[model samples]
Target: MKARSKRLMLVGGGVALLVAAVALVLSAFQQNLVFFHTPSEVAEGKAPTGKTFRVGGMVEDGSIKREADGLTVSFVITDTAKVIPVSYRGTLPDLFKEGKGAVVQGKLEADGTFRASEVLAKHDENYMPPEAAHAVEQASKAAATVSQ
Candidate 1:
């Protein structure tokens, strides 16, 4: 083959490989991406099912229940306008408590319960996750609008 043809072939092969690598990286990122949602969004059926995602809100007062096994715990997370039931089977963070802000990473089950794989609590009394705070604010605004 001519030198020119060989050079063009090499360049085209390199470009193809580059494209394939980029595509692979993006695909992996997409698969690992976790989305954030609020209780209201989950109630409205906007959250994805059978996939990992995050839900942030306040743990409702008197909603925490622990099983006899001591490892399994159930709680309700709410944005004041709506609530989602979450079941977790593991040790909880020291900061986790009822009526405090929390973010749970898990999947929505068929029965409308959130099966949590990980739970994160707000680090300080005054600090709340941005997403959780936004969700609470939005929910309160929505409630006020409905009342008016």
Candidate 2:
């Protein structure tokens, strides 16, 4: 083959390889990406079922319950406009409590309960996750609008 033709072929091969690599990276990102949702979103059936994602909201008052085994706990997370029941089978964070902000990573069950694999509580008295805060604010605004 002519040198010029060989060089062009080599360049085309390199571009194809680069395109394939980029496609693979984007596919991985699409599979691994987890989205955050509020309790209202979950309640409205907007959250995906049987997929790992995050749900953030306040731990509803008087909604926590511990099983006799002591390792399983159930609680309700709420955005004041809606609530989702979450079941976790592990130790909870020290900062976790009712009426405080939390983010739970898990999959939604067929029965509408969230099966949590991990739970994260707000770290400080004055700090809430930005997603959780925004969810709460939006819920409050929605409630206000409904009441008027």
- Per-residue error (Å), model 1, residue 73: 0.7
Q: Rate the local accuracy (lDDT) of all candidates.
A: 0.98, 0.97
Residues 1-148 of candidate 2 have per-residue lDDT tens digits of 9999999999999999999999999999999999999999999989999999999999999999999999999999999999999999999999999999999999999999999999999999999999999999999999999999
Q: Candidate 1: give the clashing pairs.
A: none
What lDDT score goes with residue 65 in model 2?
A: 100
How far residue 138's Cα lies from its native spot in candidate 1, in Å, is 0.5
For model 2, the local distance difference test gives 0.97
For model 1, residues 70-103, the per-residue Cα lDDT tens digits are 9999999999999999999999999999999999
